[model samples]
Target: MNEMKEAVGNWREAKQFSPADENDFLRWLDKADTEEKLFSRLTFWFTFRGLPADQNQRYHLVQERARELRLWNGLELKLRRWQDRVADEYEQIGKEAFAARIGEDYADYINSLTDPEAAPQQAAPEPETAKPAGVQAWSARELSEMVLPPIRHVVEGLLPMGMGVLVAKPKLGKSWMVLDLCLAVAQGEPFLGFPTQQHGTLYLALEDGKSRMQTRLRRLLEGRPAPANMHVMFQAQRLGEGLLEMLGEYLDANPDIHLVCIDTLSKIKPKAKPFENAYDADYDYMGRLKAFADSRGICVLLVHHTRKSKNPEDSFDNINGSTGILGAADFTIVLDKQSRMDDEAGFLLTGRDIEQCERVIRFDKARCRWVMQGTAAQLAAQRRVAEYEAEPIVKTLRVLLQQGDGTWSGYSKNLMEMGQRYAHTELAPNLQMLSKRIQELQPMLWERDTIRYWYNSNGNAGRKHNFRQERADNNASVPVSAQLSLRHNYH
Candidate 1:
């Protein structure tokens, strides 16, 4: 209600100038020296509303004074009502537009209007939870008590809440990649073939301003709708000053935020290494970030850099830090490209809850996002498949088939449902569109009456070879072409 009143006051002030007569009357009213002078102007500013039924003598006396003053009582009433009507319409239109912008259901928005005074306001929306103020410890005796809650991931089993670091060499599209992750989580969209939990993200791009961030984000979004959950700030305070307090206030305003990314920790980190050990100073800086996340149970991703090393046995060794930065974090992700000129790279992921796994990912120049294929060795063997050039629907079908050995058969409608597994863009329109896509895949199909459905890939042939032998051993007469090739290389 306070927010609404503030907005209304602003509206009144701005629109007061719209009506020329109101502006003239208001300017004079402000200059009035006393209550008598201000009240004299009101007779010309508004009509006196009093009736013989009025019990109050003050109301009758005011009307009598207005009649004696020969003020524009009739015209004043007309202008005030006109201004109010215009303001009312404008407010209604603004509310409708705002509701539509964030995809709020229109019916739900209407129901909320029933009790405007009772409606909760989100100055900065964040999830609300109550916590025990005092901490105590008890010896855990049961497995259930000791087990951690189901892990919540920002990048599904890859990144979770706590002080974490994402290290990559300079000019390696680290910003682009993190922005993609932030936007994906904001929209509940997929990132690198994995599902993401939707939540608001605060991206502090301390180095780059709006123009650079805008162009980079535009490329990442690729004409998609912007996510309301994602916010970007171009500046931030340094640690140990007001930075920690500023972060706390922001989280208080936006309590639901799951991910807070600070690009290039070097930018905002204190320059003086006050501690004795190299690791200690680094840990001291990150320790503040970890404490912040721990208090809120949220994720803090500190983007850092990797120093050039002579082929370190482990990628984690390449991170440009001593034990302080490394030990301070709950998780760390290292993206290392063999060459600065190439987009292909290996993503090394390690965390307390996750297995240390390496994934093969390549930058898609067209989409400006990394495409996760498989382990480096697996991707090396399948380079000839050309999965990158395949249509989204076909590419999705190919992955489904490659996952198992069977005749994966489905109708056109089913194909659309399956294709959504890899959907990063708008959903396919209908069954007809999906059927047309299948026809374009050049798959082995059953078309005795009409194209019932079918798919096949080179990878599927190897896995399905055993299936064919079993059929042949049974003396089955079904044609091999009719086999639903789950391993169909739609790529």
Candidate 2:
């Protein structure tokens, strides 16, 4: 041990030696033939025993001495070249084996403190497993199977996990609808068109008045008791904060929360250009929310509005803002009025990965609820009605006219033929109905006409009675007898 300590001190002193001396020491090591001779010479030069039970400690000391001597040599051409060669040889000796001697941790600790102010002292990092170069370059399989969260179909099953949307035009019972769903879900009752299973929920509504929300909830629940697990948050104005920063605190406190509802996304997102540029503010905000959901495995339902140019035929394409909003959503639904005065409204289910069926739900304003519009058989009947309504009579007439070479003179005959063709054995009744319907639709048909009309007469003696421009000479009157005579001759 004393010899080892002396060798360590000499090694530190050797770091200050000139390049010529370092060269002389290397030459002496090369000349030594036996291990004992080599050890004795190294000890004499370093002024310490060069051997330790651990080969790593011995090699580390030798490398350290080499580095110090090279630095002491300071910019000499031959010395610099020699230092590079020494470093290559040192690295080739297997750092892991050397590292294992004092344990990699202690080796790193000693290395770090050599220049304490220059580099931060840190815990030694665990050795990373070496991946093959081929693996690094290889692409993942395109058809790799993905694991997705299970979907709950029933309202009872959905309510517990968080699912549903309340939608309507402004001031047309949107809030009221949401309140109703919340009350139903909280009480484990049947919710608009579906039965809800009970689960702990978090309701966060920023826009609603406290009193109004409470009153509406009371109306929705009527006499039912509220669930103790149901929680309400009147304010959630800052949801975009880092997941671990904002929600981490809340989730730590309330681990039981399963369903989370943010009444409107507009209130939560800070005023930014989510609409103009999707990748900027919109992506960042949604990314944070999605990460939060994934980490917690909680269902987050966000209520939003339809675009001003919303098409009744399509629902998902009509949602407002960067398509990213809807693109990120797992499910999307739209509520719309079928007519201006119709009390019954419809909800169009647009995007749901699970169901192939398109559902049409009717809103019962009196009960403030949604109910499935028709039974299976009733649905078939309604489909027939819809088919009949959509079968365009005018379009059929236009097609007939086209087939008749675009002449109104042959229009009636062509119409009769078409009626006969379509009516099969009921031709006469069909023709009669067609003629009546056409007569009833004449004004509309004439308005759609693309032709002009005029009248002409040959200058025969019988046709050469009299002519007058009545409007041109209203006050330039001729005798009443003459005018009567002229009218009679013209006729």
Candidate 3:
């Protein structure tokens, strides 16, 4: 394969923002104090290059592409910022004026340069073709009436009605974690801090027999009534061994089941045929599983492994197989250990329709469940220092935001006041500490007016903490799962 080129052109090519101040660019773009101003800044992105003729090419679509590119903050905003610095007379005239005058000529230059931020456009159009099988266009009202994916919080954003994977190195207790998930869904109990929806859950213990599974369950249930809804299969037939048929028939029998877990990928992995491609085999297996999940609106959790050199920065990079398997799945959840021995660990959750998260966890031998220990910062990563250090304060605000209509608006002073009330301080913290905490939780926090706002993506947190309520702290136990706000920052 040829080495991939940058979207614009080259790295050292003509540019607006210097590489020296990229961090400053991100911080500046995100520093808006109000929602109106933030949206205004957002508008600048489209205005610079005329908004896309196709609606899908507009702000949201391009922004999604930026995330895929890992541009840090808002993609268009960053691009616009760069343009402001680089475009001739950008500061003297204005972005709209400069962009209109330059347009594709600028792209022509970038085509010759190395700008990774550049978005490539096709010169020649492909012939129009009929939509693929079962793919139908949606009418406006049909789309409006259709349930979009975010009616969420099945285990509070970890499990949903599409494909997802849970990965960890061997002996990191991934099985215990997933077994806890299945057991939680089966019994309508909480998984970690998140509430379970009480559904029949299938656990394909492909790597373990019934006896071992029984032992694990006893440890999890700990004398509580075993959820009859929980179903277990000691071993699974290989992919071509009627696995799909058997699983489909089982779902047919138990229509209420919405979750199926495969303990480890290797067990049920089909043997490769002569001349078969490894990537194809991996992707094909996952596609079959994903199809089953999507067809029935069920959740499938595939337990897999991470390679030795796990990328703490991006969990997807550490997955042990071809990129095709990742392409086939909806998202991934990766668990990693600081050391091979029983030590501190963290799990990174990233995928389509799931809010990205990485958090510290400790396994409790007595309860046989992972406890929310802290943020991944405890594992000693230096990036995103604020999120790492002020995780508790950020989570408190997350709970507060979710208690109301999943949003809040307040001046910095008001926010600090609220933070002080919720802060689990042994000695009352200063305004600076509280203010610093709010500032650090930026990805989850937004500004709209003179007021700053934030929300929980799962949609069911912090309603009781409405800023308009003139609310008192109610003196609760720090918003744990048992306390309220399952989606609150457990880390």
Candidate 4:
């Protein structure tokens, strides 16, 4: 009965009470109840009884009356508590979704942001792109079309990282020298004065037998131990077929190999016209070789030959055929002998990356080896000796000229006087010997004289060693008499 009465009272209040006024009413009720507890009980009954009859307004009025009576305060606190519980549940669901879509680390980062104690969030790192495997297919046309890398001198400076070709005439010990270089590199020894960086080396000698290679290697080593990192391939005939294919696999298996020497390029490249239009064929072969080296960061040393040219000075320019060969090579080294059968006399070592210099090495026939005998130091010593031997003769000649109106009549007394002043304790053979040495030095003096005459010569004869009447064009007339006075006779 009290419930019914309370409901009826709420409905009635709903018709007359505004939402804002209800709170005031509730405050009044509380005060009223302070005076009379029964007053508070009666107020609840009246609030329910005055509820609005309209469905929309009925709920609104009930809420209003509850507020007027202070009943809604407790209800609102309960509702807020329920809402917070649902929010926490939804937040966890969002985190799980993020974890599935991206990654766990991302989810954790996002979750941390909501926490008051979490640090400032950072951006995720970018993923790396995968590189393609195996050698990239490059046409000779492609390489030819692109600009070339700058040429670098080998021994002169840092040998730029790339492939190299060593070309020489037949029977020039090209193979022996290349093998020597490989052994030197493997052992971390110096090669032809160029420092060798420690590296694993692979030598493919198609022409030499295993036994012969061993013997030659022993000779080259000359009691020196072979570097353990060095590897040799005696299967020259098999190289033509699928050699590159196997090489690709071998390099993959052995990443440490830094140098590869192919004794002769002709052995590997497919048969083609030696002197005809084989640019395409040649380019393809070199392209493959270059690709192999570039892919593995290995230096490919290719042995090659020169065409039979009468011009002895022609080195790189005389390479067998197809300028494409030298064009493709990163470095080109040419081994040339100054004269035939004078191997001991000296050999010229010139290359794109090395300064052109000649060094004399002796061939120890007994041991079948070539050893460094005339290095820069050794040559410098020899030069000092020659200069010492020739000095007395030059001094004697100068003194003789100074004594006798700038010309010596005979060589004997002049030689004796020169020997006394400048020669070592034991002088050179005779005046003939000194004369020969002087003759050798004449061209050098002539060159110096030309420069001196250009600088010193004036129209006045007083400033010149020798003067002739000027022609109409102002050019000095050639001296007729070989004997000329040194002292200038001024006008």
Candidate 5:
């Protein structure tokens, strides 16, 4: 293969090709170790030459090679992806023309290829009998009027019955969570306060030994007996090697199976080729699993890890791999924590079938299971209130207000001195940070603690702040006008 690549490179550099070069390429293709490798090299060469025109000599050479190798499925996969990516542009060029270039027979078979993302077209309903097969088109009105079954969920309102990725930092209880999910589904139990459908489940514990899994299971079960329907495997073949076929056989043997969990995606995924685009590699690998799951109408949850650096704007961006993984999935669940030491973590869920949700879950160390705390917004507000009560500056302000007549008006410098004298910890690094913190906490303070803070900067005298405590009974909510003026006055 290396020699073949060098030969192709020389021909490309010289901008010339002869019968001898063509013979050498054909011979190398025959010597290729596997069909997948041959396909990879061919596509790399094709793409390197800028996806040659249909009439070009190189394009014909590739088509002939693909035909001789019987790489119709590979060609079809590429065409589908290209058609999907380029959409209207591909329609303009014609899908049949592209498939026919590979081979005429493949063009006929292309329509039969299952696209998980594409809706199946059906003919108009008959007067009595069901619509006959081979009806490929549907008008917009027909599509809109067609009644489809609702998407099923393995875990109600959280996980839909399709392929999904569960991502979190390593050692953040992802394995534990999925293990619990398997048991819950197998036994028809509620998981994290949500009801789960009872079904057979397969857990691919590729990274853990039986002993470790047993220990975790025992811990989770406590006095209860383990469910008989949940099966676990310690090792498996890589995806292309035999993983899918093995799973198919397993499903056939256990016809009741509805959930298959892979501990870590990296373990079973095939090794990527050097020439393959990172995004394309992820999409292709995940797309295969997605197709298999959708066809079986089961839930396949892939356990994955998040990137070290966080994306403040988007939680999904923190997923370790390229966007293709999320792009190919039906849904994605990300588990995030502000700190590993904290017992509570945010569980984010988003997908096509389910509405987006964010929940706060706390790890119950005793049972080795996550307990639902509440909605994310509620928990966040509670945390803020707790923080405000314990904050040194707030404590210092309370003491000063109590020592005085429940009102303090002074410059930030004076407040800093008073805070240091009265408070045990430093209020902040400097007067600037102290002022900012006070303003940042204004809403919480005013709304929760009946403390109204007003600060303004004077030209040469520096910033002056006025803090007054309102009667607890009189405090209801911060006025809209005051909330709007909070930042302005602080600035």
Candidate 6:
């Protein structure tokens, strides 16, 4: 009951500006001296229940105030700001009202609001048609008819326009990764072997000092001219205080900007209210950022850290927050490094607009940039081939196959003895070991040498092995020893 009374009291206080007269509102605006204060007051005015109910009147008053403050140029933006605030207010009010309605008579509550005789001081509101609210759905036909633009990527086909989180452990070159990305986008250069769409970029390097940032920038630039379209800031306001406003103003001034990177999400994350669910808070915070970026057709990359304990099975689980953080983002990239001393790292990318892929990248110490090696699958294939070719047992089998004119058949024991006698290479310690080694090399042998191997176990006799070339190849004429040397050098 006390909560309901407080809500009514607040509603009445908010109604002070809802009247037709502009004199009192103008007087109130006069007190907001600074630009931030002006924006804050305008936000507060639009958020409460009792601003002019007529949309046009509300806009007119806001326009007049903006014009007086030399903010007339952003009238449309201010209107959007108003709409967003009203939507938020509606949601919050609905939640509170739902909680207040428990054990209360709904018809009595409606009667109290509608009964002008009971409250003589309040004038009756004019009746207006109820508008649709709450969740909305679209039919397939409606969706099909809409011609939405393709998702534009900052790094073409990799980083699309929307909010994304890039998570890595501390001191793992995550900052350098984003810094390089910003430079590439600003200069229209390729990033990590992928083509980029050039445009303006902003890097909020809140944790780094000017000197450190300068040093890193110089290292990356390599004496090249600095990008004029790239902007950096060492400080920023926290979210809900003035951060969104600050970013929006900058974006408004620079219409070409397609990417904004916030170094360390902790710098601008809003504090949670008492008893708030962590997931709800995280989702709401990130959703606001995603909405802002999506509306402008730009990408906001949030640099963040992973948890101390890693989740080997799922890289997304290592992100340093509730699932809501990743759930709200349009995409996520997790950087994993096997060792602090290793130069190579794995980037696991998954999102709505990009395919799930793992890219192998190596840090270039000279330029302080990450160089793309290839996809993880490609690297793994190459590693397997190298390991296969270097095996002594593989060399013996290759020589035997070459001398036998690409055909050899025998039991595991016979093949092992032949390897020791002719090729002078121990195939394996025993018959069972030799059979296991042959099985392990089966795939590599077929792929590299076209030699197919199969076991022929006669029921009454014994198990025998058969090896034959799938087809004739040019490597048949090349000496086996010479081929081995050439393959080693090639790798």
TM-scores vs. true structure, each candidate: 0.52, 0.46, 0.49, 0.49, 0.56, 0.62
Say which candidate scores most in TM-score: 6
> In candidate 3, what are the lDDT values of residues 1-491, reduced to their tens digit?
01222322332221332211222223333323333333333343333322132112334433432332334365456556754665455568765444433333333333434553443342232234223433445446545654333434458666666888888888788889888888888778888777777778898888888788888889888888788888989767888888878887677567567789988887777887899888898888889888767655567888888887666677678888878778888878877776777556777788777788888788887787898776756545444554444655554556566676444554444555655567553212564555345444443443321113232223433222222212244322322332243234323
Q: Relative to the unseen true structure, what is the C-alpha lDDT of residue 396 in candidate 6, on a scale of 0 to 100?
A: 77
Model 2 C-alpha lDDT per residue in residues 156-243, reported as the tens digit of each score: 3223222334344555555655656656565677766578755456777778777866776666666676667677767765654442
**Winner by lDDT between candidate 4 and candidate 2:** 4
Give the per-residue lDDT of model 5 (tens digit) for 1-491.
22322333332321222112233344433333334444433533342222122114444444444544456456756744643554464367554433222222111122224333332333344454333353334556645654434667889998897899999999999999999999999999999999998888999998999899989999998879999889999999998999998997787567577899999999998898879898999999999999888756688999999998899888899999899999999999999898999899999999989999889899999888999999978987888889988888888888877776677788988888888798866888988898889878888777876788876668899988877778754454555655556666556
Which 10-residue window in model 5 sums to the lowest lDDT? 102-111
Q: Which 10 residues in a row give candidate 6 its minimum summed lDDT?
A: 101-110
Measured with C-alpha atoms, the lDDT of residue 377 in candidate 2 is 57
Whole-model Cα lDDT per candidate?
A: 0.61, 0.48, 0.59, 0.53, 0.73, 0.73
> What TM-score does structure 4 among the candidates reach?
0.49
Model 1, 1-491: lDDT tens per residue? Answer: 33333332332332222212222333333233323443434332232121222113222333333333434357446535654664465477664342222222212222335656554342231223222323222333423333334555777877776779999898898888889989988898888888887778999998799999889888988898788879898888899777878876676457567789999798778877545677778888889888877555578999999986635687888888776888888899899887888878889888776678899888988888888978988886565245424457545555554554323554444555656666554336775565454555444322111112334334633211211222223454445664434324343
Instruction: Residues 1-491, candidate 6: write the lDDT tens digits.
Output: 34434443333333322321233344444433334445444544444313132223445545554554455676667667756775666577664453233212222232344564532232222234122332234456645754444556889878988899999999999999999999999999999989998888999999899999999999999999999999999999988999988987787567677799999999999987899999999999999888788656578999999999988899889999899999999999998988888999998899988988899999999889999999988999989989887877777777788888777878877887887876688878877888778877877787898776666666755667777775645344534643453354334
Report how far off residue 471 is in candidate 4 (Å). 44
Q: Which sections of candidate 1 miss by over 4 Å?
A: 1-135, 142-148, 384-491
Evaluated at residue 17, the lDDT of candidate 1 is 21
Residue-level error in angstroms, candidate 1, position 434: 44
Candidate 3, residue 351: how far the Cα is off, in Å: 1.0
- Candidate 5: misplaced stretches above 4 Å? 1-135, 308-312, 387-491
Task: Provide the RMSD of all predictions against the true structure, rounded to 1 decimal.
Answer: 21.5, 24.3, 26.3, 29.9, 18.9, 15.4
- Residue 87 CA error for candidate 3 (Å)? 69
At residue 89, candidate 3 shows an lDDT of 57
Write model 4 residue lDDT over 2-53, tens digit each, in one string. 2322332332332222222233333322222111222222323333232222
